[model samples]
Target: MRKSLLLFGFALALLSCNKEQAAGGKEFKTAYVDTYKLLEESEEMKDFTNKAKVKEGELSRELQQKAKELQLDAASFESEARVKGMQWAQLKQQELQKRQRDLGIMQETFREEFDKEFGVKRDTIVSQMRKFIKDYGKKNGYDYIYGTGEAATVLYAREGYDITKKLIKELNEKYKAQASKEEPAKKEEKN
Candidate 1:
């Protein structure tokens, strides 16, 4: 449904733009960007992915530690259960059940946190790319800058109509400058 709506809106825009160009007697320049190539070549995305991997490792390690502790607790309880009275064994069983439940909650918390963080970062990157593309189009006199990706709507474009390489280069340069600017601020805050 969402894809259909987007396609309809895009078709309407194209029609309006075409009508305007025909009536106004002015040629409108248009180009398409390979979004896959842009994201794949983006330095900021690479760095972001590395950061996410590190965080994933940290989370995995935390979970592993908890799992190890749980194993030890289970082993201890099993060994003591045989010697303990019925009432004591029941209490130990309840404690073990509580620990298992807590572990499950911990796993869920880790998953939610990872998803939330990644989602926010992904949204930010997409927004940044869009804003950059919009500004670039305006500054360079482009009437329209379309995107071509996995579900590419652009079936065919002439040789000069694809500006993926130039856009990627500019985006990377901007990202590098932004990263450099933030580095100093981060260092100052650490001090």
Candidate 2:
């Protein structure tokens, strides 16, 4: 009778522990976003890409024009050097060298400026997106939101958990509202 009672007590303890464990285990809500799709479809990103292209084209055109002018100057110098004395030719050659150096400096300066501006803008946009996502998660009661794309952090998630389309729609709407607000300010500045 004593052995049977001990065995029953042990079984009861085990059942109670199992019940406690089951009660403590809670399921968390999680979702994922396709980062590549977000960036590719977002209005702000598209606008930035278009503006960057235009800026690059402008810089390239400026450089090409400078190069063409340099070529013409070189041709003129060559003709003048053929008709002039050695001393005049030497002076003209030095001047042409100086102009070539200036053109190189300008090209380097333009490249550096373009890179710096775009880098800052890119960083800003990414920071804004991260903040937006964090806010979205909190607002929507998500315990966790993973990012998936080229640098995918979440490799496998259920299709139902993908929130890329929803995020893109909200993000574009925010961008459009911000742009509209800025347009009035920009027009005011013009006036």
Candidate 3:
């Protein structure tokens, strides 16, 4: 739904820009791209996903070791003992299942955290880009500004029009500044 609106708006922006340009002596140029998708494609998201996978592997290994320790067998295996063994196996299976469930919950929590942090970081970066674009457009006589995201109707855009690299660059700068400020505040609160 969000992507659809963005695409529709993008088409409208282009049409509006062209209409305004043709109707008057104005020349309007606009472009749209999804900043979030670009960020997800970045190495940072890959690194985060890799870390989560490693953690899951470690958890699985630990659970396996635990299961081995608990996989005990009695010397005189009677009918009752066999039934007890079956019950023990069932309980062990449940324990393994619970561990998997916990691991899944942890992974979900990490993904949510990553998404939230990425969203904030992307928003900050986009905000900085928007400021620059606004100033640039105003000075260059641009009449309208549009945001590009997953659902923008723009099937294709020129490389020159893609401000993604510029936005990403500006975002890292903005993120570092914000992180620096936040770190000092965190340190002070801890003290």
Candidate 4:
């Protein structure tokens, strides 16, 4: 009887504490951003994509021209080799082989260089975006900021809870400010 009374008293105290806590329940503020929309609508992203495309096209054209030139040279060498003596033809063939090897190495090196530079640029952009979102969430008193993309990790979010536009606007403003600041520095360096 004594143990049962003690247990009942403890249970009553727990119930009272729960009632007090329930009166002061905390509500979490959460928001989600459409990551794909963010990237698509971002001015900085558009500029970067445009610049990258132009550079890629130029590089591809240069590479293709180099390949075409090499092909033409090989064809010319082959035509000459038939008329030339066997010994001369052998020497020319070896020279053409060396040139082909060199071209392959050059192409490989160019691809690696372009990929490394582009990858670094892409990674930097993503890192900056993540940092900006984290800081934005903290500044706005958000408990959780989730990212939803084409893959649809967040199946559904209310329109009011979608912060993609505001976030992209802030990001673009920052990017423009930074770009303007850097442009003068670039001109000064060039001079």
Clashes within 3 Å, all models in order = 0, 0, 6, 0
Candidate 3 local lDDT, 115-180, one digit each (tens) = 676567656755665566667665765544555564334333334467889999999999999999
Question: What tens digits encode model 2's per-residue C-alpha lDDT throughout 1-191?
Answer: 97667656654653454344223474455666778899899999999999999999999999999999989988998788889978999998898899999999999999999999998998899789878887887777665566756553543334556899999999999999999999999999999
Task: Please list the Cα RMSD from the true structure of every candidate, rounded to 1 decimal place.
Answer: 14.2, 19.2, 13.5, 18.0
Candidate 1: lDDT of 51?
A: 93
Query: After superposition, which runs of candidate 4 have C-alpha atoms over 4 Å from their true positions?
Result: 1-24, 150-191
- lDDT, candidate 3, equals 0.61
* C-alpha TM-scores of all predictions: 0.63, 0.62, 0.40, 0.62
lDDT of 1 by residue, 107-183 (tens): 99999999899979988997898778878877787767777666645423334567999999999999999999999
Which prediction has more favorable TM-score, 3 or 4? 4
How far residue 93's Cα lies from its native spot in candidate 4, in Å, is 1.8
TM-score of predicted structure 1: 0.63
TM-score order, best first, reads 1, 2, 4, 3
lDDT for model 4 comes to: 0.74
TM-score of model 4 (CA atoms) = 0.62
